[model samples]
Target chain A: MATDSKQFDFGFRNGRLRVAWYALLAVLLLVGGYAMWLRLQGGMRSTNLTSITPWGAWVAFYIYFVGLSAGAFLVSTLANVFGIERLHRVDRDALFAAIVSMVVALLFVWTDLGRMDRMWHPFAWRQVTSALSWEVHAYVAYIFVLMTELYFSMRYDLARVAERGTGLRARLAGLLTLGRRQLTDESREADRTWLKRAGIVGIPLAIFMVHGGTGVLFAVSKARPYWNSGLFPVIFIISAVLSGTALVMLLYVLRTRLFDGERVDRDILDRLATLLAAFVVVDVALTAIEALIAIVSLHPHEVETWRLILFGEMSWSFWWFMVGMGWVFPLVLVSKREWRRTPWLMAVAGLSVVIGIIAVRFNIVVPPQIRPVMEGLPHGSYFPSAVEWATSVGMMAVGLLLYTIGAELLPLTPLDGGDH
Target chain B: MSSNDAMPGVPDTPDRAQLDAMVDAEQADPRAELEDVDFSTELGVAMAEDAKAVSRGEITSEEYWQRYDDLAAEEFGEVYHETPNPAVDHDTAQTIEDDVAESLSCTVGSMASIAESLEEPAGDSEGASEDGEDDDHRWGMVIDLQKCVGCDSCSVACKAENRTPPGVSYNVVMEEEHGEFPNVQRTNVPRPCMQCENPPCVQVCPVSATYKMDNGVVNVDYDRCIGCRYCMIACPYGARYFDFGENYDDEVEGAGEITSPEYGVDRGEREPKKSPVGNVRKCHFCHHRLNRGEEPACVETCVGDARNMGDLDDPDSEVAEMAASTRAMQLKEGEGTDPNVYYLE
Candidate 1:
């Protein structure tokens, strides 16, 4: 225990910081719990949504988390499948985040459902034509792939840790090892093989089935012309990769600085920054092209949708969160070699991208709905109600709580010196 | 000539015990016993059958006598006497006739049944399922824009009949005015569920909860609906609405006590977060009313009488004829939804 403590801290070794983090999470859960209770009692009435605006903040959050999960999993593939050596340090972290984010995404969707009890209906009764139904199955498959990858990636480290001591962490690690305590080279090689296989399967599952399918769910809606473009799904994929890479970069730097008591990996941060910038460039180009076409077409609904995003009441979300933070600021920060060298600067860029993608999701969901499909129908108006914001925060806290507990108990950090 | 001589083919073998037993049986059920009796002629058989009907109280004696008086005279000539039945209570028969008349004028109950029966042939013409199979129809509607007064009565009728919760209107009227202040033309377009042949809502339902019925109406199976509102997003016309469980308890007393029988399901009492309360609901062309041979409430209650519903499959039907006219057009036709509802300019 002394040696392990000397080497690295899992959560916050400073007991006060740990307590504060837990306390913050606990407070959020308490508020969120009350809000969720109200939501359950009041049903859809608690929401400001009308028939014209059937979806709201929860839907945006759902897509946001889906993009995050897909992005994180794709980042993990950088090490597990593509064998990027520097990325190996955060591959397991990214994989775990992917699992947690996916669960959070699904939780958002479940709460958004009118019949939360009937959430299983999508799986039990398969509607071949529904993109959502296909997504339901894909999410299950993706989660399975993620868990399998995470298990194989950690088994060796868990076995090593389990053999060390009689403490609770050791006992937990021993149980997680599933009695496969054989620490032979063959077992390590076999674990790598399983991880690679899972990652291979998961790449397409994450890209085409999970996030791309969510894009298709919108694109297929001929009612909303803004989302009907062929490029929508492609943009979704690119943005997902961008967000995932950014989240992982942020996680790596934060973990190194706060918990691991180690110097941040500059090489990995540089590569991730470059990859994230590339994604951002692609995302910006595609979005610009999409907007240009909509503006040129002069189709009323299309124009109206864009107008809503750019100039409507909620336009601040687009200009500030999406364009400023999501695209411009992050792109500028990551563009410079000197800034990329600064680990905290890279973290800020990553944070900006993460926050910006959330606005991107909101723009995707809310704008098109603001313009009524047919004119003279009451124009839809919406803002996330109190319950909505509270529940969203609570769900995010849940994800953080899960990740915190997992990080403390599991061998998520690489068991090596800072060189790797 | 005696009655027996006139009917020479008849056999007469009267046993006192059998005759008494037969008479007793006739008292029990005149129609059943009379079936065994042999008559001399068709007229005799017809008169005797009616006489038995009168005796069993199936028909009033006056109705029976009025029916056979001329026929009896033709058969029996001078022997036919216009004698009223002593067994029938004339007072009771008069009271029954009076009650029927009073009930028809005083209450909707009997009138509704009468209306139902009167509508039977119309229902058949409108392609009500003859074999109790739904596939025979493609129900349709045609609205004349010129006739619409823009009163929103159709919307009101729809709300009243469906008892849809707030934020869940199955019908709406889109009104617009064109041209300058001096010469303006106002247009009111009443919208209901288009019941599209290729409904985007049905195509995107994750649970197959909302589906296009063979009868040309799109149905939302509330039991199966998870209420994701995907169909609401998918629909081009914005025809679908989610029932958020809001009721008119404040304005109308006992509003929640009785719910509209939509899709022929009696979803009694608008309970909070029940099947329909949590489900996406829309106009099913008043399927419950359609099942009972009645028009959709919007069509029935349209003050201007602008709406007409009929079998689109039937070329001779009013809606089909109107739909075929040059003035007939569908909203958002470029979307290729192939809406069942048509508007005549």
Candidate 2:
């Protein structure tokens, strides 16, 4: 038993290492914030954005985090709403990750808006026709739902922390509880009842309204024939699920390792890897259908966009990042029975999937803009400037920092009871 | 009570007393008063009563008027004698003449009236006479591609005339080569804004920045353009270009010295990021030259007699006849854009 505990404690030292990582992230975020300040001082001219290519890195990153947020949230909802008990261990962490990812997504989009001062117009006017206008409303609603769901899931634990009444954690827990305490069996039962109901409702809202709606945003733009597909939204939702599962698996392994806690359920991680692999297959299939329809139509604009994505300037991203790193590497890692048990190997696979999805988002945004609307008009050539890259890196660091802090402060992991 | 007060159009008299006695007898017998009374006075009173009846919704106006006419015929031997006075007709004629005289003093009002009058007459007498002449002649163009060398002189002349900033081309020549390589023959198509007969750009403009003129030229109101660049996308010819805050200061010695009052608006000097600088601009068919009673710079400088300018309604005019030519066709005929600028092969 002692040897087993010692094995579990491998490379796990609490507080010190956690504090160091947090400090590093904090520094990176500050640097990014400074870069963002520089960007605001100097207008779009400071960036390499031109009339030909109006959107660039900020837009790419905006969609990337949106995908990640949607993906992570959906995975957590699967365990909570659908009674997927195997995923329960990582579900709360997924929820926290989602909230952080969404915050980062909003920051990227906020920076991209032409007149950031008039950011209130979308909410104020509420243009029913614009997909972007609808997305703003959905994002707000989704964030509220996430927070509520997180609160319910953490309610019993928060009450425990409030009862203990020791450090900052207890104070925060008390504040979170809003002076309400429910430590009895009946009250816990009531809390569980509310959480179950909220989770059940949240499942469809997350899938159809939030993530699927985002897919509809791109799919509905008839100007872009490549994006105009009925299957695109389905693909988006599946990819969300895939990315969400992968994120949860990685976070679970990494967080457990950092906290000097018991080993994460290897069986659950392996199962998540399998689920992710399945989703990747579906995603690849849908993508194939999308490309095939475009090719068969033989429309000049569609053909040109396809050529640019497949064989032209952006092919490296498609072939190397999306197919190679995103699909093949993860598939190979998850498929091997021996490798499936290894936590670090699975983490590497999950990390690759996350990076690959970012490439996918970049490919989605930049390729379509490269081709001009008119035939004779000049085609756009775009490479994100240093400032754009720096701002993106900074925003990502901020997201990571938020997630880390939340994980450290809160009892994001499940308590040592209520197991069936 | 008093018989003298009862008579029609009489203050107090014996006739009133007599009429009153007759009215009393008519009240008793009804037919007695009808027979005794003079029909002319009765008829006039009846006509007045009929008008009142119509006003009261008792009888239709047509029936009332008809009955009045019959009564007048019986009383005066002809219905024409009681016809409404011809003075109303005379007054109406005089008012119409006054209105015409008043309106003719203003240029737009006069032009509107003249246009309304000329619609039918112009169609009838296409080549009859050119009586109405003004210093401000409406200029238009017809490019016959058969004679065009595709030398791009017209494009050069236009660039020179306008001194357009970079990325803003007022005119362009599109070349199409037909058949596969070995058997291929080239066709040169010089395109300016169709100045479309029914310009889609003018229709979709939210600000009314672009509009069709009476002289068949589709013109842009530069000052009104919000620089939204919607019109640039709407044009089928890709004729419209956005002025992306560029300047001709580097390319030409004094290009920015004086701005062309192209739309007849005297914008003083071309400045960076100014109204027209950011707005969408296209060929106005040279409105400035048209105001000066000269052809467009492109037409005037064409080496070949390839360009023709005339009223399309006049069949005798070169444009009207050429527009009907077997060799002529508008670009993108399938689109139903109805381009005013026709090409002759």
Candidate 3:
């Protein structure tokens, strides 16, 4: 029942379950709000960032969510662009996830700026060589494109739900539909065509401008050898595909099976898990090649940074979380023919991969920066302060809260993928 | 009383045997050392022996000089003019000048005369002013390795002169030891901003808050800087640093009252998390000091006289001359930054 975007006939019943969900969301909002308050009051001093390690947990989360959003958007294209009816079930969910993650990412980066008040400068004074300046423009444009595409995808559903209901959802749907009461085959065909075009155009934009460009933010830094390479942005794209696939898979299972306690199709679960397993292999392969290139070059500066990532203080993040749970464990669960058929195992694999993606983001940001740019200068080390951790958790909670409220108030799930 | 107190003992001169051994051991070429002086060993010995008499209250210094005058006239009766003494101090300043000149590609005689004329180096394409003027005085420094004792007075003086807040040092000393323990080479590299002709810092600054000045110094416009700190990551030398609104409030006295007039802006009072407080900062070759016809704080306070600052465009300047020396090298030439700072290894 919760697997689709268009609402079904069943209402938000089961008062106790609704209350429990709302309570969890409310607690998250309250606690996360307090942490956010501390951050605003204290400035960057509330974080563990130093002059040496300028970017910390916030920057990590900023990129992590960006990957997830780009990943989710691209996953939606599998249905809208490629006409994959099997994946149609998650299209609206994917779009909503994309929008929410982008919001979380933008906020994280906005606050991470040294002069948060002067955030307008990057827009006002655009320099040609500055990738960061270009990023602002691209991110804003990407958001507009996402919202427009999402509106097109949901217009018919809104019109349908509005005709049948007379409560908050109906009123909101009417206002959103702009008073267009008629629904016909011609209009529905036009909506499908527009959606297909939007998805097609958005594919390259999501792959290159949004996620790959974010990778370029670090790759262009000649000072940090770890990130300066042609392969970096490519790795970012592949990993985005990987994490995006995992996120959609996780959300699908939670929405359908866990929260709603409904049965899901075995074919969808197996195929999604298989896609995730394949992405993990590709992600790990790219990482191995990157490591091999760095290790064999024997450049002390480059080697030291790699060592910091592989065996230094936060080595466990790479060795355990990213490799063991993120890749190997997920790979084992999904690739095994017997386990792949089990819906719970597929969900577990999806959950492990989504958590591991966060670990990937941290390793990418922290380790290279931890090694001093020069030999004698103080090497950086960072563990996000309690406030930083809380704020990040709060932001994640906020993402969930938004998802929950959005799920309830809007037509997020329908029986026929909102087509009829 | 003064003479007696000065030379109370050792009144009697050493005997011939003792003098000869002392001469053989310590004065292998006594005459060479003695040439500039009045050449009278007898008069010198008599004066030394009489010093003991004076110390014993046998005679005064005045009386001693008066008694030795006839011998003193023969001992020190020569007018000497300054001349190169290769037998003693082998390398004079003139010789160094000639050697450095000889090594340069410029005509040997021309290089010697270059001391008086201001001209640019042979290959000076990089670091031209934004206005595309190459004739402007591009300030530069040359750190001499032999002279740099690495006392880090330069770093301290930079802090005091710039009045940078905590964690905002514009200059730093990087030290490392290489080779085997028995034959280890300890090297100290005192790093300031490279002030590259094609600075990556200036290139990456999204707001263009940081820029290369007409004088070839890279400066950050604190008022305009958004504190993105992209420059810090782009800098190959790690010279650019972020001002994370940290202060020496607890560590230093009256910390907030101290702030530099950087970029010639009177940003009064280092408020907690203000313009420069949140902006990126770096060495500007002490442009504020330069406007006042003074060298950088690091150059002014270097105990070893290791750092030299002058107009690289002015060939007559010491920095220009040293920049042309064979030992002169810049850090990270592969980055193609073309740093104005030179290191004489």
Report the number of the highest-lDDT candidate.
Answer: 1
lDDT of 3 at A254: 72
Under CAPRI classification, how is model 3 graded? Answer: acceptable
Candidate 1, superposed: residue stretches over 4 Å from native: A1-9, A417-420, B1-135
Better of 1 and 3 by TM-score: 1
The window of 10 residues in a row where model 1 chain B has the poorest summed lDDT is B87-96
Give the alpha carbon lDDT tens digit for every residue of A1-420 in model 2: 122223222232666776778788878878788888877766444566655455678877887787788889888877777778877777788988988988999988877753345456456543345455567788888888888888877777777766764577777878897666887778777766777777777777778877787777667655456666898888778777777778887887898777646676778877888888898898888888888988899987689988998898779999999888888889999998778778899999999898888788888777876776545445778888887888898999988878876875676876642253
Give the higher-DockQ candidate: 1 or 2: 1
lDDT of 3 by residue, A300-415 (tens): 77799888888888889988889987899999888777787787777788889888988999998888778788788888889999888888888888888787777666665544
Where is model 3 more than 4 Å wrong at Cα?
A: A1-14, A258-261, A418-420, B1-135, B179-184
What would the per-residue lDDT of candidate 2 be over residues B1-345, giving only the tens digit for each residue? 447557776655457878998878766443445557766556665776777888899999668766675566667675455344232222222222445665663223244354565464334222221111321223345788778877888889988887677767788776666799799977676778787776756654545657777666777766565543435434656677766556667867777767766755567888654557656788877766555446788888899879887667666667878888898888767556677787787
Question: Per-residue CA lDDT of candidate 1, range B23-126, in tens?
Answer: 88767454555556653355666777787887899999779867876666676655444333233333222222446767564322343354566666445533
Judging by DockQ against the true structure, name the best candidate. 1
Q: What share of the true interface contacts does each candidate keep?
A: 0.85, 0.01, 0.64
TM-score of chain B of each: 0.67, 0.58, 0.62
lDDT of each: 0.87, 0.71, 0.80
Among all windows of 10 consecutive residues in model 2 chain A, the one with the lowest summed lDDT is A1-10
